[model samples]
Target: MFRPENAQSLVGLALTLLVCWLLSENRRAFPWRLTLGAVAVQVGLVLLLFGTPGAQTVVSGVNDAVDGLAAATARGTQFVFGYMGGGDQPYQVTNAGALFVFAFQVLPLILVISALSALLWHWKILKWITQGFGLLFQRTMGLGGASALAVAVNIFLGMIESPIVIRAYLDKLTRSELFLMIVVGLATVAGSTMVAYATILKAVLPNAAAHVLVASIVSAPAGVLLARIVVPEKPGQGGYYADYGSLLKYDSAIDAISKGTMDGLTVVLNISAILIVFVAFVAIGNSLLSIFPPVLGQPVTIERILGAVFSPLAWTLGIDWKEAHEAGYLLGVKLMLTEFIAFIQLGAVPEGAMSERTRMIMTYALCGFANIGSVGITVSGMGVLMPDRRTEIIGMVWKALVAGFLATCMTASIVGAMPRELFGY
Candidate 1:
């Protein structure tokens, strides 16, 4: 099954690692052991979640929740369009396929999941779970305590919310630790987005939530390795919180829902604004490209160029060559534009343009905000949270962004290449 495309993808990943190392401020002093340990722990987590029946049940329950949301969206679509959303209307749909163009179209799951997650946190369920994971990271990966919490919270919460959990110590984090946080946040998607992603990729990829969920979980360690290489941890680094109790504070269920909904609203608004401009720009670019038609030379579009450039990388993740380029185009758009924009485009890919495996891998790869714009946001947001360390945050932005992008790529490669049965597909 291994082919030239696979080799190309591997080479691309290797090149990314090289790029990370070359860009590091102190690559010479990188902590190799710690990096390897983090990778090992991540691999183990993936195995436990997917391999064991009991663990799979829990994860599957989460997946079921996302699936239910998708189904509900279909119903809501019907309610809004008066049977048109029920597959009755073939040609006329909104900008991104107006299935149910409303506030809750596919994003309500974020509110639901956020509320539930907050409840779990209030009940100490997530706290206990993350504590064990955190202990392993501390003992094995040798990561700073606050950074570990950020990574775990990233698996559950939005980037902005996760960092606030450690707000008290933000000003004290080291350069390497802060970089790791930024990379992890950018590499992983928030739980609220799972339903939207599932809805977009479900037609082409089986077990969409499973793949996306696993991708975020696995990206943590990959982010750690890349971040460390970019700015090696100071051997005797101090000022990291080691105790868990101080950081784990939970309000009641009502408070959780209220706060969680507000958080989801911010995400929704951000997605809306970003998409309006990004799509406009893409349309403009396409219009410009349309001038040079097949009459003079073959028609060229932004998607086509991206597909050609990233197709090899896509194939390395076990995607068939026939569909690799389309998948690659999606990845390129996700990285350069925004994940929401990419997901919308993904839903509209011509029938049979991408294979199941390729679509699945692209979904995982494009789950987070690993683009250049996110780098600026993270640096600004986290810098303000830690005003004393603004300079350090600025220093690590570029490296963290690159690391985050590569981490998602690495996660896709491993998960996509593995046995499909692992995803219950």
Candidate 2:
């Protein structure tokens, strides 16, 4: 089994950091302490959660709750769509295999989790957790209070929704702080979406829920650390803002849940539409590629092209060379499309296509929301919240995407370096 103390893992860690450093906008001013601290924190948390029996039990409990939520979603879908939606039926049929109908089985959990998150936010439970995390970032990373709070909130809320928490300070934020927010937002998946992903990945990875939760938690600080390197803060420019007040509010518990459900419906519909369109596009692209001369008795396609291009990067993240191309293909899919699409494809991967260790690394690597489509969404959503900074946000979009990509890869490399025995592999 792989161990963290090995030379190969150390080389992987060094190469990961080196790539981030080489991409730094201001190498001289890069925040080494923040980067090192973020790595230490991530490794520490992973060991505590994966190596310790007590923490593993807690993670298992959370996974159980996720399973329960998934089951409840099935019940709701079954009630509406009958047997096609996973309900009991008198005779066997292929209706359950329909893409449109299958979406109902998994996507409804987004509604439930989103509504539950809103209710918790309204009750200030999420606020307390956000504040606690914010303070840690403020103290450790030297981030302003508003920036730290926004980054922390990104763990639970969507990228666009998180900025609303620090709305008042958006314009006043320093360049580095603003970019950090964007990078963190792109780097981490929202909690509601995380549950949906966990459900999708449950078959191949039994501990998918725990891994998704840990990936989000680690990526926040890691994103900030990487963002600072890419766009280092100017001296005497960043400080905690104590006056940013709460922007999320509700009339009552019912109101919170109602609005959350409506918002989730929008997300669900958006995802369904995107999947339909993107999948069709990929198929069309592959058809065009099929006209090319065969390679190894198979027609060249987008996946193979992506694999050839990004396989080296995947190998640097500690994926085995033999499986690096497959992992790279998934990574490319994530960058070109969305993590949701990439994960759905991952779920469909044939057994023996990649080793279990490589799958775990890919899971963490592709956990972010950084993709070409997300750039437009971030710009439009953040534009609505802070119109004055729309131009700046647009300019920073590509850079933020790169930073977010590196951050997720950084997390994956760190996880890959950890001893496999710790995960009982």
Candidate 3:
């Protein structure tokens, strides 16, 4: 029998489609075929990983790499926060009960990981991986080579920096191509951000890095589909031309490591500031809601209100109603606010706030960069790299935002639909 949670996930999927209908600028002209194609890519990811041993072994290998990295992060966390990095067991007194210190702690890992990843790329490991994926994207989605490289690299690099891969092509990209770039940038999490998010989600999900890595990999093709639909592909578009032969002239090994470290620091600082403001906002919103009449003898908060509003959708996405409201509220917040804040809230959920299934479902759901703020970030960052095409970048922001959200939701649905056996449950 299909679990109620499975049925609920489908319901959430339907609601997401409804949201797309309501928000799309030209609803009558929406490219349903490409939208469905994006969803199909997500489904394929789940099936290949879960249904076949060969595929599972491949995914498991990737998962092991992620796990190894995450374990390193945990040890680093232990060094910084002591036992607070682990559990609340006795004989373990923690340094700071405050949240700010908690967030600041272990942030150094971002720098370490960033520097290491740059070294890996400098050695051509990540470049080959990204190019291989880019080639596959070009074949399947029929995207331009330059655009495919940018999107694939964005999966492993920050939004601002990924466009540098195709610096020569940026200034010459067409309007539709520019839109695709923005959409892909806004839809996927960069590699540096993934480590930060893993720290946040680790408290809720057992294998957070594995889930995050998978989410980004799966979202890549979805981003391609959505971008193509947002601005239908133009025929006779010139293909991408690369100057990688002289990439070392752009940066030596030491230069790449230093540059990556600086970029990661900026990202870490931005994250710190955003978390401070969002947490305060959540507290204030919840405080105001507490003035309302009690429901079931409990004062209401924004989390509960969000739960009430999004619970049905959550149920449809394969989460038990017992845990649906909390998960649903996070999804709504992720869409309306930012994925970073939603992830923080997800981590802080009180024990018993969600079931194991709900936590697993949400780990995939809240894995994108689809909030309104990212729309602006994508435009500005890409605009700087391709100043001549600023108008085209501006035009695609809204469409990219909408399409990116749908692509992430498509991922959530696919993961939710897979049989428990596939997940070894």
Tell me the deviation in Å of residue 105 in model 3: 4.5
lDDT of 2 by residue, 1-425 (tens): 55533335456567656776787778898677887788887888788788876987978897999999888888888888886677776776665445335477778889899999999989888878888888887877778888988988999987988888787777788888899999999999988899988988888886889998889888888899888888889989978585534567888999999998998888899889989898899999999998899999888999999899988878877787888888889999999988999998887787667677778888899999999999999999999988888888898889899889878988888888887767666
Number of clashing residue pairs, candidate 2: 1
lDDT of 1 by residue, 1-425 (tens): 44454555555556557778888887677666865676576667677777776876777786787777667656755666554455466665565445555454565555556666777777778878777766666677777788888777877776776778888777677767777788888988777776677776666666667767777777777787778888787768843775667764656778876876776767777777777888798889989989776533567888888888987767766677777787788878888898877877776676477556566667767878788667777877777787777787787677677788888887776565456566564
Ranking by TM-score: 2, 1, 3
Q: What is the TM-score of each candidate against the true structure?
A: 0.85, 0.95, 0.83
Sorted by lDDT, highest first, which candidate order results?
2, 1, 3
lDDT per residue for candidate 3 within 1-425, as digits (tens), equals 46665665676676666665565445566666666656766777666766666866775676566556657866776676674565333564454454334554446567767876787788788888888877767766666788878777878875666677778777767766777777677678888778777777766676666678778778777667656655665558746755444342226789878977887788778767776787788888988887789998878877777778977766777777677777778978887678888877888886466665567677777788888778777777777777777786777678778878766775677678766656655
- Which one is best on TM-score? 2
In model 3, how large is the Cα lDDT of residue 165?
A: 74
Instruction: Give the poorly placed runs of model 1, Cα more than 4 Å off.
Output: 1-13, 52-60, 69-98, 248-251, 293-297, 316-318, 419-425
lDDT (0-100) at residue 70 of candidate 1?
Answer: 69
- For model 3, the local distance difference test gives 0.71
Provide the overall lDDT of each model, using Cα atoms, as 2-decimal numbers.
0.72, 0.84, 0.71
